[model samples]
Target: MSAHSPSELELERRAYRARQSRRSVLVAIASSIAFALVVWVTVINTSGWAGVQQAFFDPAIAWDALPRVWEGFLLNLQVLGLSVVTVAIVALLIALLRTLQGPVFLPLRALAAAYTDIFRGLPFIIVLYLVGFGLPTLADERIPVIYLGTIAVTLTYSAYVSEVIRAGIESVHPSQWLAARALGLGYGQTLRRIVLPQAFRRITPPLMNDFVAMQKDVGLISILGATDAVLAARIESAQTYNFTPYIVAGILFILLAIPTIRLTDWYTARLRRREQTGALL
Candidate 1:
């Protein structure tokens, strides 16, 4: 055989590998199906499947809950969008403040540190309660509940995001900052033009993770009865005496979360590849 051409043995080996790969995939699928079927059969036989069906699998109840839950989910998306934007902006500022150098910036740095610590230390529900119920009254009750809830989310997440942003910023080497300074760039210019871009790229995976977490935590706003999916489900369950609406809401949340989860996974994989490449270099 020519140097580039496969020999007969090589052709047979390739064919065998391809067939093995296909067979392995089929086996995996069949095994998964069989395992699930066995578990399901056990559950159905042991537990009263009829009660389970009535509680969780009622099609009519699900159908009735769908429209209201969807309407509430739209509100959830709105709040989540606003909170994410707010958190991003606030966290960036806090991170910048936290990273500031010298006595001139000490107070700001301390305040930023305190903010992150206090907020991060607080339970999520307390933040919701304080912001949703407490903050509005300070403004003579002018703020709307949805707006207040958004603020709560913003306050709670900004602490976490600020830490992530700070980590990203600090991960950029000191040499890059010095190099920018050597080019006659000011501190702000160095950060804006040289450091932040690389930092953001390096931290995309963690930031994506943070955003995914925030997506699900957005459900907490429903506790304030602002008519989010969770609240909608609760209301429906109360009316119907069936818990299927909660399941429906849970499924809706899972559906909403899937894209972010996939994106997080993709970004993490890419980050790993880049780190591996750097290690090789």
Candidate 2:
């Protein structure tokens, strides 16, 4: 190969370095602006520097309501786990029905669509109330409001998850199904062995996103009289006649949300890399 001219090579190298330098400067400026804005808002809204100092050193509120807050946190975790598991199972069934194509499937698809649309359109509080109060009257028996809240979360979230799963399944290539059928695999065998595994991998990021969304929705259970973290905080605040319990609860929610956020980001990045490598191959 012929060697490049010195001037041309130097110009290309300088251009590459300039692009990297510009990106670095842009990132730094953005970070600085964001940090300054956050500080300005915090100072302005929180009674200046003195209030910020007091907030950091405030142990009085935390010490008093820690027990109640802990209990509420545990309850929140329980509801989240139960609701997420229930929703996942329901979502998978809905996804299967959605993928089928026939006159038989039309009514099933319509029902799934209605389920998704109604719950997604309704406010979480309304669903909570309907389940909590409406069910008891209809059944003529007192259902525990907490269990009702779990059902509400599961029903609403499963609708959303079903759509996610259906999209994931549809993204798989038709050739995979053709190949499986050529090998004498039945519909169920092809779906189980060849389709769902790939779909699950593709759907992992959205599933993680749904999970994080569900974590926040756990607070909605509190509206139905479930003693979730938010409700616990409110009760503690009422008893102590202090705003600190609410602040404590907010911090706890942030703490809980952070791990889910991190996990989602990590899984998304990993999947993206795998997808890119697969594409290149």
Candidate 3:
């Protein structure tokens, strides 16, 4: 075979990769369709198929529920937005505190550790209930449900996020910290400019996964009557005596979450590609 120019080789490699990618995608889709057909056949052959359709798949009910449920979902979007900021700030601070190097910080480290352990070990529902309903008993006036739900989400996710962030920080070689210190950077400066950015990049996938979970868990806040989509669905179901609205609400959430999940996967894949390119060069 004749030798190829660099540009020709690059073009050939790209074309080969594109063909392989298309083949893989076609195979995946074919497998999914086959699997889905099998499941559909099995389901329709079951004795309860008609009942299931009536209860869960009524097209008219789904259509009717869409508008109301969507309105409630807007509230969920707001909660998710606020909670992301709240969780990220609190979790990063907790992670940093846990990573402190001094004996004087022992107490703060212990406190942060305890906080994470307690919150992580608690059932999410319990935390939501305690924050949403139980706290108001001690106060003279009712706390706004939105704030309470946001607090509950923040407390729960921060514990998890802080631990993920801590892992990312610990994954970085200690030599980097030593080098930063040797360069006369203070602890705060080293962390701010060097450590955290790398740590956060490492934790991006897990953090995004948590945010997806948070997107759904905020549905639990509907239990406090905050009138989010799930709550709206529940109310509509109560009035109509059908469960299809809940299914509609669930479908909406899945649709909303798919984009985030895809984005996270893409970013993680892009990072891997970049790392491989660097390694190869």
Q: Tell me, what's the RMSD of every candidate?
A: 2.6, 4.4, 3.7
Q: What TM-score, computed on C-alpha atoms, does each candidate reach?
A: 0.90, 0.82, 0.87
Q: Compare the candidates by lDDT and give the number of the best one.
A: 3
| Candidate 3 per-residue C-alpha lDDT over 146-200 given as tens digits, one digit per residue, 9 for 90 to 100 | 8888999999999999999999999888998999999999989988888888888
The TM-score of candidate 2 is 0.82
Residue 268 displacement in candidate 1 (angstroms)? 1.7
Error of 3 at 3 (Å): 11
Residue by residue across 1-281, what tens digits does model 2's lDDT show?
Answer: 99966798899999999999999999999999999999778775565666654553357877777788878878888888789789989999988988897897799888888888898788877878888888889999978766787898898889889999999999999999999999999999999999999999989888888888888888877877778788888898787666677778778778988988898899899878876995773
How well is each residue in 144-243 modelled by candidate 1, as lDDT tens digits? Answer: 7678878998898999999999999999999999999999999889999999999999888788888888888888898776898999999999999999
Off by over 4 Å in 2: 1-57, 278-281
RMSD of 3: 3.7
**Best by TM-score, which number?**
1
Query: Residue pairs in steric clash, candidate 1?
Result: none
lDDT of 3 at 178: 96
lDDT of 1 at 124: 92
Task: Name the better of 1 and 3 by TM-score.
Answer: 1
Question: Number of clashes in model 1?
Answer: 0
